[model samples]
Target: MEPVTTHSNHDEPAAASPIWPWVVIETLTSPDETTVVLDGASPRAFSRLNRTSVARASATAARMLGPLVAECASMSKPRDKYFPLRDDQLRRMMTIPVLGPSGHVHAVAVWVGGVEEPLPRTPIIGAIEWSVKGLAVANPAAQYLFRAPQGDLLTGHTIPEMLAAFDIWPDRPGFLSLFNLENLDVAADQWSGTATLHYDNPTDTHELFIAARAVGTGPNRVVRAVVTDITGTQNPGHADLTLVAVRAMPITPGHAVALADLKTGFIHEWLTSSPSSPLAAWRHHNPEFDDNSKLDVVQTCFALATGVRDTATHEVRVRFDPADDWIPLLAKWTLIGGGDRPQALIDVTPLAPISAPMVTGCRMCQDMANRNNAPHQ
Candidate 1:
């Protein structure tokens, strides 16, 4: 039997800090049900017993491995198991089923403690291996972040699939581009950025700081990512507006218009003084523009940003004064790029009142009026 080698010297006092080693072993089980240790720097003291028997070396492994192996077989993916040792020590074991080119598990890789230390859930960390087959390996933390389905793992699923399933759409322009795996290479060592994600359930939002680094080489290289929820650290109780559309001033200023500019434009274009104060006003000024309408706009904007749609047109009813009848306006929205900032452009044109009859000869005007009258579902 090979001697178990570790940095901790046996001559050192047992009272000295103990260095725990995690070992990997072959999957073959003996008739006695003992596992053969392939390699690891195990404690020399523990080696006094059967050094090659992983079950004899660590009581935690002896207990956890049997059940974990069964889970991997049934689920077709590895699951993590954690157990505690004496002296407030925690041990985490992650089993990886190594699949051969034929899509069969040829061997198993058991990664034990010493890597994932200081077991705190906050600022979660995970490891992933990317390849042509999508995520070849995703740690349990990564599975939780992507909201993997119960009894199923994140392995074999693409990033976009997980993002859509969890309703974790990127909140800013060009944010989704970062996940384009084709752009990543061995030369690309690290990535760090802040991403805001909008959740559909109960309409919640989270701001996350993500940092990742490449730890291995080739197409199947391992990348470790750490995500920290920084929502509370930012301005409290306010959603950051991701400006999708910006209207430029018509004159020489040529700068994007602000909210005040919108107010001024309303007065100049509609020939009426603003009725409601700027603070009390909302966009479109239509009673039908409720939470659902807002959500539709958000989804449409995301779709446009992600290349799902090219252009979307709608008819909006607006009124400067509450007492006055609403004015029908045509709004056309399209994605605009090739500038420092990503933005969309909207063209709004005033139309005849809905009560008025459309021109008999004009097909476009008839269709526009018909759409304007159609009640939104």
Candidate 2:
């Protein structure tokens, strides 16, 4: 049998501390069962148990090894993983494996601690291979890794359970599986897109955004990605109204002709259209534009910034007060590609109430709208 070795000497009284304690035990593995060959510890804990067999010391630990050893043996490196004994009060155990020449676990090093306390990281028996910053062995909600198409491993982490609570999972397991390597398609340099995913229940689905960066080429085929559950934040309680479309005109210094800008609110409001204040489309400096106009002071300030544009068309024309600080706007609407923000120039002609021909045509259009929406008998 190999002699047991540890960083701390068990013989010295000064060498022992409560926070950093050692309990080394030798394991005798047979084809049938595993038992304790020796119970090694310091003056406090294991020293008193030198006479107890593995079953006498803790039968619970002896049984827990079945699952723990199986899990530790599956890992690629020599490291200890924490497994909480939920059935036992606040009790946690670790499976630290000492590797042999064949790169297989030859013996198990165990650590018993409370919920807050972690296992000692220093090597007590075998190889010093586990990362100092390695994540706790608790079962995380999700684990992900990013690699180059050529298989260079990049950044990865155990997606914390907190995110799992919000339901962040990949849609259709696009490239997260890692074994098939087809899942690698979810990432690429400078990629931004949305996909749905599942969690605890495979049938229960949620959404996530995949953003990737190509990084570089060749041996350094670096790619980066951020998979996030946007279901929580998709509606920002407001929208960032960039000047999507504009009809800039001259002749009036402070007096404007048209207004185009962004508004903030839930995304549903951005995608939907209604006749009322349409899109909460607050336009600045207009009181009589529409009865649906924000009849309150809070919106008066909002319009001063987002432009008094109707949410439906995202365009407003100062047809009411032409002589005053007049601004008029027109927008082209498409039901299919509303999400596409395009930078194209289009011509516009303002409405005039006095033009009999234009007035008649407008009245006809209004009648057609009323007829389409009128309920049938």
Candidate 3:
């Protein structure tokens, strides 16, 4: 990608537009977290060899070169001036060298001033050449694990810790390094803007998808990692988007599901508590409403012959009969008076079946039969 140029004037406010164009060179560190910034003049002026060019160079030198001299005087700064090209200076950035499939140096990425950049080949030819020549005899152990073309290391957790959580480990020592991280399946390079990394552990499959241009950077060149869990199922009424409802339904015959419709405020309170119930789940899922408002409804389902109670206050009690196969499912809907809206929203459906007698003998039935000539109640 062509380096972006920003123009700024020295005489005007630092924020003002520039009269002369400048290219900001960023070097990224190995972890891709830290960065170093360098300011360069126009390509035309850098190509010229004159006193004015040298003076302009000196003024800019104080910003970057002073630190370099204090740190290491023997270091050779890049002669290109358009971009830094010194060997020792480049190595100090501590970027991992990326190799192509053919075992050739593909790119050198450095972390500088919190930005990651792949240096231009023309300026860093010497460093690339040197790294290639040494590759033939590089450490085999190091080569095996740190060979990933791209991707950052999983931070804040060690490989051992991850393995311990699953009670397993790779058979080889080199399998745990950052270089061995699987290449993100998504094409992030083509993205024109910031990228996001997504981790999915669906069915315990450790995989990642790189979504390009999913996030944007700030003025400081800080890249944010955006992660989404693709494996988890989202419940329509639950917060934390659970895959399975904490409440269970019986699979036996003659059993039915029952739901409760509670006020919205109480539902919100439940969801905020630890081990939130279905009502809490509903509130967690819908956060747009104020908790102080009356609850439109709270719904819950019960299996016939099961006893359930509110774990929080123990004030609500519900019981189901074994003979009841159909239970009501509850839903709450807001009603605005004198409006075209519905005054209430209620949906009751049979969730299961009942095995009890299908018919009953009633006095009304006998009276109807005798209505022609006999007495009726």
Candidate 4:
């Protein structure tokens, strides 16, 4: 790969700079938990860019380039996923790489964020880019989009060399990326935007958000876009904003399947740590909650369980009683397992629509339900 652009700082790269500095080794000495990858900040933050730096590279440098080793030692194996560094201060970091023909790292990129923030799969493309790898989409129905003046879409399943296939749309029907594009051209190398699209009905769609950054100054610059989902709100124009109390009884033998094995662990964890929990910290900045908040959470889960529906076909539903008018959308999703293991996906769909409020009492009823549901994080 040709250099994207020459840099003034010969070794260390600026945070937003397209320049990537990585150690391309025939192999790492020991690619294990003790792999001594990048540690905390140091006065000598960077090593020399000499040809033999691979033999003398730092753990941080080795980790920044997460390529399969060319030669594994007796105890080592090929990496199935990214590495986890040992740094108490840093919550998480991921090293994504572009591999060459020999399956060695040609370029490297890194992302660091807090534990609460989900890891981003945003593409990192540079002018000196490699072939675009097909995205590992969590949901098969997810719409992959490419930005252009007329709003272009990249066809799914097939990996395109570079991003040449960014605008092949309508060729695949039913499979679509719904977005209301306000900006046609993204001027910055790094930028993010949200698009609101209607699904099922014009009034029922949710927002699709993307944050992307380009890595190269040249034409081959790879563009990485990270996508995430946010729960949608009711459109005040189409539907009347009214309260509804969904039937709070558990699913019968006829309509729904049993709740996913009540996470005995969550219960166990809760039981063992009741008195020890920081009640003040939990209620801080919120006067609405008191010492009984934890107990209220247990009650709320029981009530929400009424809305939890699992079909005979292994479909799942977690419904809010007074939700906005949204058509039942059945889709398959692969949720994260304990770690890399992929959990079995459920065919999720709503058992029934909230047609109307079963019973609408005074403000007292609404307040109670809100408090009951409040303990749910």
Using lDDT, give the best candidate's number.
1
Poorest lDDT segment (10 consecutive residues) of candidate 3: 125-134
Better of 1 and 3 by lDDT: 1
> Residue by residue across 1-377, what tens digits does model 1's lDDT show?
01222223222222224333333322222112223223242212112123534445456555566656555534548667655444444456666553432233322445545335642222333334444222334666545554555644555544333333322223322232222333221134545455555544645765554444443444555443433345555542333233222221341211112221110011101111222212112221212333444455556555554567767777656553344465565656665542322345555555653332232333333444566457999
What is candidate 1's CA lDDT for residue 326? 59
Model 4 quality (TM-score): 0.21
Instruction: For candidate 3, write residues 1-377 as lDDT tens digits.
Output: 11222223221121222122222222112222212121232111111111222224323322332233222212222211222222112111222333323243322322221123334332221111111001112222222222212232222222221222221122211111111111211212111111112223424332111111111222222111111122222211212111013123222222212222121111111111222112211211112222222122222211110123221111121112233232233232222111111112112222333112211232322333334335556
RMSD over all Cα atoms, model 1: 17.3
* CA lDDT for candidate 2: 0.30
Provide the lDDT at 108 for model 4.
33
In candidate 1, residue 128 scores what lDDT? 42
lDDT of 2 by residue, 1-377 (tens): 11212223122221122232333332212112222322333211112232333323344544554545445555623333333232323334555544532243433555555446755663233211111111112111112211111221211211221122222222212222111112112222232344444544667554444432232343333332323334343422221222221211232221212221112110111211222212112121122343333232224324332334323334444332344333344433212122212111222233322221112223333344555457999
Span of ten consecutive residues with least summed lDDT in model 2: 127-136
Point out where model 1 deviates above 4 Å. 1-124, 132-136, 165-188, 196-200, 215-218, 235-377
RMSD of each: 17.3, 22.7, 24.9, 22.5
How many steric overlaps are in each model, in order?
Answer: 0, 21, 33, 13
Per-prediction TM-score: 0.29, 0.21, 0.18, 0.21
Task: Extract clashing residue pairs from model 1.
Answer: none
- Cα displacement (angstroms), candidate 1, residue 190, comes to 2.1
